[model samples]
Target chain A: MADPQGSNTRHQAYFRANLTLIGILLVIWAFVAFGCGIFLAPWLNQWRLPGTGYPLGFWFAQQGAIYVFVILIFVYVILMNRIDRRYGVDEKD
Target chain B: MTVQGWTFLIVGLSFTLYIAIAIITRARSTRDFYVAAKEVHPVANGMATAADWMSAASFIGMAGIISFLGADGAVYLMGWTGGYVLLALLLAPYLRKFGRFTVPDFIGDRYEARTARLVAVVCAIFISFTYVSGQMRGVGIVFSRFLEVDIALGVVIGMALVFFYAVLGGMKGITYTQVAQYCVLIFAFLVPAIFLSLMFADTALPQLGLGRLGDDGQSLLQRLDGLSTELGFGAYTEYGGSLINIAAITAALMLGTAGLPHVIIRFYTVRKVRDARSSAGWALLFIAILYTTAPAIAVFSRTNLLESVPETAYVESPEWLKTWEDVGLIAWDDRNGDGIITYAPGAAFAGKPIYAKDPETNEPLRGEFGQRLITNDSAGDHNELYVDRDIMVLANPEIAGLPDWVTALVAAGGLAAALSTAAGLLLVISSAVSHDLLKGAIMPNISEKRELLAARIAAGGAVVIAGLIGIWPPDYVAAIVAFAFGLAASSFFPAIVMGIFSTRMNGPGAISGMIAGIVFTTAYIIWFKFYDPSSNTPENWWFGISPEGIGVIGMLINFGVAIPVAALTRAPSPAIRTLVQDIRVPGDT
Candidate 1:
């Protein structure tokens, strides 16, 4: 059975931690996808990666951002798993 | 063997592999049919999801669009991939924790309303159909090229294959088959891109090769941009459309991707909520292999096109171009005996006008879609060529002179991508009809056997409808998929998001919000797509809001309406609020 009272301190802490982590990761997503990819593409284009010869923004748009997104998801997974374990909400054996 | 023979052999072998997998993993129960017994390994499920998510548009059409549309094509790159961010952060793990067989099931349980479930089923079916139509058409196009059959016949063959797996094994068979499909499609897509990259840029990696300097001391992008400007087109490397439109379209596609019932269902198939999170990551990595590679392929192919196809030598054009041209994709008005082909954007009357004369001047102008009426010696008469954009990816290997076996492999790859997505979508539509609609609403006591029967039958119906759509494809098969994404974004995305995050949200709010979003987005898309196709241009669009991006506006409207409506209505019961809490936490059970 579950606790009748909702919003326990543990629940609140877990929620806050989860939201904070999500907020941070999403900000990173916005930065890479919209910032480097679109808004700053022109400014970044002035600088090219040495061997690749791609403008910074264009590379971010085409490739860099995707790599970041994959990394971000994994980070979220690791972080959440930790928080889940801390709060005793993780999958039990 | 001939290229056609190679294609037949490769496509035949792929289908046989999928069928064999289907036989091995037959579904015995509804759970097995719907969620593959909830036993798929995260990495394997990730691979399957990548195949399931990448439809014909991803395989056959994305590179073509990127080639023609240039830098603006990043909307697809970011939009299709970025949605996984939202999937990972906001939706996937929570939904997996809820542990449902379908997306609508989640909505049904969360909202605890029959009406909400029904509306969700409707949205799922609608989105899936629009999605599957584009895929079936993609299958037909590939078939028409590879099999030397009519487009309709190609679609039928694709349909038969989809029906075979989806109806028999449901998710159980389709999951394993999709894993096979991911391998086939990726290999098919990479070979040509890699070969072209090596030949032109002296780089082995196509992604890096795209950014490398061509042998001519000019970056491929620089050369493509220069050629585009000279040809009166937008630069390939710059944002061609309004920034707002680009952002909006990308956001809509991303949200729509997250909202897609078929994609969301993939998360539910994993063993644990944690796998759901990791699987989405793996899926993105799998997809990135193709997504990142597509832009490079686009630039490579476009560069090849401008260099290889000489307007004058077009009649004796390379075997690949001739083959594509034979398929009615390339057309020419050889008014002069020069045998050259020209495709200028506007008003280059090469030699004569037949029927399509200038409205005011009565002088014949040249264009493929509209024919001219008068015969006149025009200066630009020497060359007029029409190459269909859809053929760009297919013809890239041939254009770059890759071996015939590579081209044959491409056909197999395109089919695998299309068939995998088509099957995934068909299952979603069938489950929406069978599990959500028939059993949930219309017949609650329906046995598992009866429900499975309904599921199979509904899938057959869905395949037939999708085949019909393929036979009579929309004006642009690729763009039509945006409508599906847009619909998902506008309706399902909001409903599911609010249902999970907003505890106070009531059924009426959810239902009304979805209805409003659907109506607004659907009306906008229909108005622009069919009723006023010309008005789809940005100049006339409201705030430069093309129908593709209107989903963002629709989603906002949904949030706006639902929040206010929920505030005004009675708050949900404590039990319902607790359920929301249960979902928000990782281990609900």
Candidate 2:
């Protein structure tokens, strides 16, 4: 079983790293979706986008946020694949 | 040929294509039936998943909602796509590594409790059934309108198509068929949208067209906002709902999207865990294509309705305007007897609108809303046009003066969206019954052949029930659908997340957390949705949380109950502990 105590410690460290990674991403998500999209939308609307006439908050809620969500998923995929390899758990294929 | 003949030809051809694909890829084993033998390419599965996920609501209903709801409609766009971030990160990869054919398989195995599994099963069936009923209803409506047949016959035709694909080829059949469906639907959606975008804004792309100034030198959205406020409705570009309601509603939809069994099951069809991760990105990319273009369609169609139909005397209205008016879907009262239709806010005018005329009776039928929906008010007639929201997508081509073929394509596209979702959902329901209920709980030693047989039978039975619900659609079907999303968010999401993330969560915690979430959320929905639907406004809401957002609270209560209950309970057994570690890693024997 590859030394129970040693593997257990290794597993805990891997788990903690994952949690930290996920925690950071989730905070970013909550900020863009809730903090910016809703609460700050009206306030941000005061400043019109330089090129686009849309208010900053309106832009964020409608288009900016979805683009960011896509970026976030890509980021997660790239980062987690790295993490998986580092932890020796990457997919075979 | 005529428009009706063209529509019949296109829709008929599309159904034939779907049926042929289903037969070509029929599933042999239980694995083939349930998870497509886990052999689908990530990108292809991504397309199939997109078709399955968009549903009639996304295709037929969303633009309609946006036409009326204005800025509030952004919630669906963000809510639907944003959920994929959660899914790709939180659930998909890990579930794929677990290598289960069904969601209940994961819950049952993870918690090491039959009851926990059963709860997940019940929630899966309930949510999928509610969702599928809406899809069936969508198909019936689309077919009936297109073919000019009885709605019930349309439903039967829809049911027969689903039975051949879903019950015959299972996931394998459904998968290939959905890829074809995605092509049909996206093409249908984009064509009318692109044409209108060019006509109005002169932009080639609908996405850019939405923000660009038209020939009149005003942005489409700006003009729409101006038009909306002039009629006393909220501004189109401005956010509509309260901040808290928007926050909660968006969160509920995101979490619910992530939790949906039909969507999650799609991940399992991919060959590797990595495919599961990347498939979500692709799925979102595909869905976002339609979702982003939808608002533009809404903006264009609403603006068109305002410009072309009105001002012209009813007798001189455009051909497309008369077409819808003939179907009793659009009505405006000429209260001033000027013979011109002036639509304004409902409360602005005292004139009541009546259905133009009953074809059979050659007399005006009572308007569907039955209150002279347009009323005899010339005072400030608030766009008193009773434009049925469902007609937005269906009628878009006609309104835009597009070719008849494009209109026919939209008809086929709507059918594709509804059929794909119905098939995906029926698969979930059947697996829940055959795999979870009969085999997992009742007959543990059932043969594989028998299980496969039971699955087909279960699927057929579910179609009948779902079709019946579609035919006699419940009074509050749409609201109940939102409630289904609520049920999913409150129950499966928390349970599955807890099981995977927390090694400390015992079966007891999982059980209690799910029960608490389901019971609380359901009671609130029942109270608001059934007991007193009239008082479902924010004031009557608990803490001003509307029923649409109540699931967020239910999710929190689940966490609240789970953490405490788990802390007090015995730790998960050592075997279960190792199972979690095993499930986390991919490419492990």
Candidate 3:
């Protein structure tokens, strides 16, 4: 029944960290999808990639963005687990 | 058996199997009904989630959208799948550890306010209904084309199937059935894609085959670009829209996927937080099988379609064109009675080319009567050939002259995909009404038995409404569904993340944020989607973001509003803080 004010501070820190990670991830996601896929597509098109006729940006927009997304999920899981443990809120069976 | 009989038998059998499974696995208790007694295996849960997430839109509409959009179609493939990564990393496991039956339960409990839960209920209903309407419409469209049934009758049949299991068996039943659906849908999607790839590129793997250019030794994309350019359309691989718009739309689709309630609720069905995390990874893997192949399906189908009918006169068009036309999918009009098909850009076809004269003697300029098959009728005259984008995937096997059974299988798969998602969304709506609204808000002391009854009633009622919408869908099923994503991202995602991770996000702040976000996003969509003049123009957009991309902006506003409000508001009670801490630490539970 003790006041959980101190724990609230800990929770707040965890929340902040999670939000920061989400923000970073979101920015990178936008960069890949919008930057490589659309905005920079013309610039990236100058360098011809081997095998495929598509420019680098076109590949990233269609295929690379998805690959990056899969990697991001794994990164989130690893980071969040550490965050959970650090906050002493790790789930136990 | 004939293709039609085979399709009916296979699809009917799958439906029968689904009902049998639902009956056998009907939940015995309220918890069992709502969250599968929280015992779903990570892999199984992942498969079920894939089925739940891939609706009629994914199966029927997505590839078609990609076919017309060309290289840009990658947006759907990447955006939809990438959201799972966001879900896995940013949301799922922690939410599961928070241990709630529905998404609103977590919001209400975390914020320590019934009002927050109610706000969540509104967002949930709005998002689910928008998404469900599209699925119902997809079902009707697919049935009308393949089964030759009336669209309204098709929607009713789909509604009845969803209502039967969703009301009777609840989450436990839905989870198991979805796993079966995932298998059926993936098989249905891949078999045709692979067959078409083989026909087009001599490679059975659709992904690699798509890269192979046709027999002229040109890359597939190069050939497609040439064909499209020849046909008076934009290049297949070229960018079309403003960079900002593309970026915004992609972001909206990704964030919206992360925000969807039905998707988030599936994670709660697992036994532990770890399972939720693992389940998301597995779900992405399952989804990737079809997601990766979808682009290839688009490429191969497009290549085959063009090659089969390019420059051919109406009388000489391929058999598949006539077949698809009978289904009202492909249409053509020979505006001029030129015995040959002419495909070229509008400007190139202004007048008859002086082909009768020698090239060395004749100038490039020509008279009004060109040898071109198309006329520049100022009204954006119809092309002699018109193909509905939705048919790209569904009609792919038939287009490539694959075996009859493969075509039938694709039909069954589309139904499975549509039905699974419809069931999942229906459950969300019903649970929100019965559990959150009835038991939690209106009748706090209601018995479990009474609550279950209410849940069933809600599920049945939702199916009927969704079916009605499906039969007579609004003109903007895709746009409305996009709006649903915006609402989910704006309202639920921010509140849930804050509630779990931020102890200071009190009831008042969370509730206010949810209300603000939902209201703003909904109003924005309504205004632009329904009210605004020149509604489709990007210039008419708010802050240069189209209605499609506004969801991401709305999410930021929700977080912006909620965090500051929480700082100014009084802290939550000690008891509520303890509950928050308790939910975060599974060992304490």
- TM-score of chain A considered alone, across all candidate predictions: 0.88, 0.89, 0.88
Candidate 3 global Cα RMSD: 7.2
| TM-score versus the correct structure, for each prediction | 0.92, 0.94, 0.89
Q: Alpha-carbon error at A37 in model 3, in Å? A: 3.4
Which has the higher DockQ value, candidate number 1 or candidate number 2? 1
Candidate closest to the true structure, highest TM-score: 2
Cα error of candidate 3 at position B15, Å? 1.6
TM-score for chain B considered on its own, for each of the candidates: 0.91, 0.94, 0.91
Interface Cα RMSD, each model: 1.8, 2.0, 3.1
**Candidate 2, lDDT over the whole model:** 0.85
Candidate numbers, best DockQ first, in rank order: 1, 2, 3
What CAPRI-style quality would you assign to candidate 3? acceptable
Q: Which CAPRI level is candidate 1?
A: medium
For residues B227-311, write the lDDT of model 3, one tens digit per residue: 8887767877777666666667777778888889899999999988777887898898888788877777777777676676767
- Give the residue spans of candidate 3 off by over 4 A: A1-31, A48-54, A75-93, B212-217, B337-378, B580-586
Error of 2 at B352 (Å): 13
Summarize candidate 2's per-residue lDDT along B351-425 as a digit string, tens digits.
Answer: 233434557887655543232233343545445356778888998888777888998999899999999999999
